[model samples]
Target: MTNSFINQWKFFYPNKLPISHCFRQYFSQFWFRIHSLPESKRYADTPAEYELLLNRHNQIIDDCFDSNASIFIVTGHYFSQSDNNKIYDPTLRLKYEFHPEKEINLTQANPENYDDDEEDHFYRPYSINEIWKKNEHNDLLKKIADDEVRAFMISFEQNIIIAPYDGGIDFIIFNDAKRNELINKYKDWLSPRADGL
Candidate 1:
């Protein structure tokens, strides 16, 4: 992690936790969830489903960013306190192997942890600066859709965070107007439940 990126992130999100799943709760007014597949299916069961899922991801991402936009791709690595080699999820091991970039120990840098009762694990963040290209991240997105890996993309220039998980994508847009415009544009992808999931 470069000092420039760290400083930029802190400027946009001071004292905010980097964990992707917690974004909705922490920034509820500026957050929205869009299901990757129809009927809120968690994973792609067939080739067609995978295609649809990728299309949704790519389209939404394109709308959130400009063509060939600069993006910060962030992934988390949670290792046990007793053993740095022991990761909470085995699939994440594969992700780090592919990237192999130095990770920042968020557990030590950030003041807050995700949970209070669970065993303490070091939460490290691995980030890379890349240019957003349509369909260029299909492989990574596929892993996310299969629940094999977890990651999120941040566009500091756009002032938005696009976090894609196994089932859906959680967007943290600071601008109320932009967020509402997305919610309206992707209304069909929004969860049907009253809670908006």
Candidate 2:
């Protein structure tokens, strides 16, 4: 299983280093735990459903590549409130390409010498709200949610997946309660700007 996953990663990211063995180990362990969850309680309704979701996600990725969009995989910490009044330490989470073109890496450069155009491939942290706002006009997201695809909604909140049609009112996929908290927190920051295609 680990080898297979690594092979797939290599296939997708031929130009980059393969995911580390340690990260693959953790990914395999997590996959087992997630796969064991009951069908109804799990993220996907069935194996087929999961596969369809994955296929759509892959297609969007392929489109990005074909369009020469700069892709960056983002990894960072996110704050979540605990039961106690005190705030818990930031939890590690991974998000990818909330806005692919806007991920400007500036870490290696001195602030005095910063140049936006020269550092366009670096990964940058974006708030959940920002990601949500960006998704509003994301062509990939809209394409995934098209009626022909039967995807009622598409989301970029935590993971990239198209929600299966459930025969109900179509709604934005990222409107869940936890995401609402993040949106409310960042609502005052800035209005979402449309990305230039």
Candidate 3:
């Protein structure tokens, strides 16, 4: 389904902003309301099945919020990079709490083994205000534009990977083998169509 938020953003910004900038701005204003599931869920099935799972997960979150529970909302950006035939999946968690001062350390919350030398590599959780502030920076906009240009120049293929919180998986698996398998399996489902068609 087309994202109305992105559609409205493109309508307003058009040529005035980079696509990445628009994406960050859109997400900063509206986030995915996901239910905190006990396990992660995975669906390599049809797109319709995936949509059903997503809706179900969101419904759970809606129910929780409607019940007035103190919910800790967090966003996860799952990235997959292939280097030397090895695929690495890393999820960066952006945690938001009602009180900025009480923001929890995501590294500690979800402990993972990291190389001691990789001190600079860590998932630093951002407060809600910080996300909105970052969206306004010119430097970030430039960086995003440069990255998109580079990706386009290199003919990089982008795929949307979705892993439900209750899918019993901590990370989205997109290794070269799995990536090829999934693409071939869902080739028809993944094909692009004309906008607004």
Model number with the top TM-score? 1
lDDT of each: 0.80, 0.28, 0.26
TM-score of each: 0.84, 0.23, 0.27
lDDT of 2 by residue, 1-197 (tens): 32232233345434432212123233322211111112222244565664554444344333222333322232222221222221221112122233212223333422443554343223323222222222232333323223222211212223222222221111121335633443354333222333100
TM-score for candidate 1: 0.84
Which run of 10 residues does model 3 get worst, by summed lDDT? 149-158
Off by over 4 Å in 1: 1-3, 86-120
Question: RMSD to the native, candidate 1?
Answer: 3.5
Highest lDDT: which candidate? Answer: 1
Cα lDDT for residue 114, model 1? 41
Ranking by lDDT: 1, 2, 3
